[model samples]
Target: MVKEIKLLIKKRQSYIKEFWSYINWGIIVCSWAGVVIHIFRQTELKKLSNSLENVKGLKPISLTFFAYLDSLLTYLTELKKLSNSLENVKGLKPISLTFFAYLDSLLTYLLSFCCFFGTIKILRLLRINRRLSLLTLTLKKSAKQLLGFFLMFVVIFVAFNSLFYLLYHSYVRHYSSWLDTALTCFQMSSRHLSTIPDLKKIDTFIAAMSLFLFILLVVFMLTNMFVSIIVENFNIVRREPFNHENEVELIHFTIDKIRQWLSMSTRKRKIQTKTDPITEFPEKIDELMLAVDKLYGNTKR
Candidate 1:
């Protein structure tokens, strides 16, 4: 049954590979189309600007080859943002439209950045099946730990930033701007630890400490998950019976092979004898006894 399941998994994986090959080509074509559209739009804008009387002598600067690369990146980013916006529309059940819009904006920005790295990962997966397989297995084992760490890290970071903002608003009455207040608070926090102290500073310190602890906890949990997964898979792969009920079958096969080789060796030893067969039998018996003794010794050690 396990072997059948394994074969089924292999077949499914082959189907997935074929599906991804077509999907990857489609994405590549669409991405190129987006790039071409961007280039055409830019060209038309430049032409319009050049048609003006005051811009007759002002030639538009030619975009460097790298600019085309940048445009491709920008296109992918926009595609990811559009996908996230659609997700936001789907998630507008329990939340207000305004709140959903803000959530959508934040999620879209975060997902856009995530999509860039995801694109790179997908490319790698297409190029190397073994690495992708290993990564997939690792992700499956650590998914819960990874999600826990991500949520904890985000919560701690946001809480610290929010507390800092609140403290700035409460203490400082007149500042040039929010940025100035932020900079001033950061400078003050760095300058005096013992000279000037207050509850707000203590609150900020506690928040920072909580953030540090959360980060440490995340690291420890992830490391534990990674190590446990590797060890478990290694044991599963290297086990003698391959975690099946055919252990005695394998042992019997191995013993038969060993007996055949020993029989052939004994025949050769008999044919090449310079001494009495009776004497040689005792020596061979002694050798066998010594080998068994050594095996036992090693096992004990």
Candidate 2:
């Protein structure tokens, strides 16, 4: 079994290595192809531009060619600028800097997403442990309820976000946009509470009322509902019965089996004590007699 497992793992690793090898080769080929194509295009365009500049008379054909060449150069320049903006960040134009910033932000978000899912995948391996399985089990059992709750939460959240944006967008800086308003609301819910003071400074009456409603609807109601759902599902998951062995038990069982298979167990094998054949035969006969008596004459007709 161990040999077979090792072979299977090696086979899988070979396939992964081959896949990545092909991907690397393909990237290299495509990159060189792109570089060659770009070089040829640039040289050809430069030749055309030089020839057009030396023309003595402005013929209609030359004029049209010059115009086309100018437009192409402009496009190529923009493309080169874009590539340079991503490749080299020093002394970038404003538009290029903005593009670079957006690219960085996007990469940052993607990395965060990758890390988040990677952690979840790692945690999945710990499901053999009882303590770790509870969290996953709870989520599995309460997935539907959580989804429904999240949808409802989003609806309520969006409504409040829009309200705050409309209410305080003119006066308060925090509620400037939908994103800012949502963030501000999250901060308030998380016990930051500075948004209320800022809102109150703008309009005392509106801020007081908005605070009461937000707290009642969002902070108190939604927070408690989410906690209650999780707790209820967690308790249910805990109460459910499972016969599967946990991580520690499984590990010990595996270790014992391996030790026994290798003839290395701490407890030695027991040896049977020999008895005389005459005494054993008499005992066997007595057992046979009891069996016959019980089968034939145990109950009287």
Candidate 3:
């Protein structure tokens, strides 16, 4: 039984090693391919823009592209309804879906370049630890990647805001008339908000609070999801014995082993005896000693 168990552990380890080996190669190839594709895409976009200039007022082409974009956007919005089901689709795990969703968000913002490079770095790091599970490593990598992205986001956000303010002061001041007209148009377009005398203050506060609450809710949901996955994986690792074959089998085997060891120890203790010879032979020894004394006294007499 011990030999069989050892064999199974060896087999499992071998499988894990092979799986990681394949994964490492796949990651390397995919990363290189992604870089090549990105470069090709940029070149293509440049060529496309040059081609667009030669075509006078490609309104039809622009309309078709916009039409497709609108359809795609509508489809994606509707797909939200199936988010729960899509998450558990056949061969697709929740973590995998979450990862793709993160990628999709990054791609939409043209920030996938950061993710691509981050993934390559993560893969290289992973190659150093073959014993680490892919899911565990991926979760860790995803967290670090997200942190990097958040930092980038902060830097970009601050830089853009600063640039915008600088441009606003330098350029917009020179177009004060245009700015005034634009502000007036915006105010006129949004006159309904100002015109509501009775509900104006109430609406303003409610609107502001509602927006704040919505933002908070979104942040809470995302945080919950991230924490939940980490906790779930941690729990799985905690409850599972590293060398256990199956969880159920491991539990039964552990119980049996404990029971057998207890029984053997109990039996061994029962067979062990410490006898007192004086208690069992007290008469024989006393008579022999009395006879010896009598013989000695008779000799003396």
Candidate 4:
């Protein structure tokens, strides 16, 4: 029991040492900090804007009367101070907006990374499940081939993006810029066929041919090649013997023990048996049917 406790502590220490765990924790901390900072800044900004608007609505008072002169002077003095304060507040508007913009962008980026890294961490946690780990295993095994395919894909994609941009830059808005053209091409390959209509407006024949070629080369060909590579690697990996069954067995055992402790019955699988009638001999079909009928008749009697 002491050895078991020590081993558990060592395992936990190793888990804590993992860099991805640190990344996830860092993201959580930063995200919470960003949320708090955003709320505080937003409240302060709104208060400043509202105060400026309220102060701007205040009209100037006259100090023409002698009896009311003292009160008017004091009111005018306070108004002047408020006006000066408004000037300083006005200066902060642009700076505050810019800061808020930057903060919002930073928070968005952090959240995106948090989601991505969180998924990776979940996969790490669930790596014991072979079905869930198949994708990672396939990628690991086929990394070289996938890298090669990616290089080739990039070359082809760049060529097409360049071609599309050069050819339809003036005619199609999607191809107005190199970056837009590249995005449009990716969308096109992913079945976003919206650009085809725009291209058709330019020249129907050219648009038709471009669509056919792009679909054939990128969508069908490249996609199938990628799928084939992954599937081949998956098959190779799946055929190999697994050594993690012991861990899975242990998990099952623990679950079963818990269920027993709760006095819950374990699920029992019912085995179904089936018998198929033979019909191999076509010439003996009538005899077989007669025999079946006779058997049924005897059972009925």
Taken over the whole model, the C-alpha lDDT of each candidate is 0.48, 0.66, 0.46, 0.70
Per-residue lDDT tens digits for candidate 4, residues 22-43, read: 6566666766876786676566
TM-score of each: 0.33, 0.52, 0.23, 0.56
Off by over 4 Å in 2: 1-105, 246-301
Query: What are the per-residue Cα lDDT tens digits for candidate 2 across 148-206?
Result: 99999899888889989998898888988889999998997776888766777788998
Give all candidate RMSDs, comma-separated. Answer: 18.3, 16.6, 23.5, 16.8
Worst 10 residues of 4 by lDDT: 61-70
Residue 25, candidate 3: Cα error in Å is 9.9
- Which portions of model 1 miss their true places by more than 4 Å? 1-33, 36-40, 52-132, 168-301
Ranking by TM-score: 4, 2, 1, 3
Ranked by lDDT, top first: 4, 2, 1, 3
Q: Which one is best on lDDT?
A: 4
- RMSD, model 3, all Cα superposed? 23.5
| Per-residue C-alpha lDDT of model 3 across residues 18-49, encoded as one tens digit per residue | 43444444545555665565465455445444
Predicted structure 3, TM vs. truth? 0.23
Winner on TM-score between 1 and 4 is 4
User: Number of clashes in model 3?
Assistant: 0
Which candidate comes out best when scored by TM-score? 4
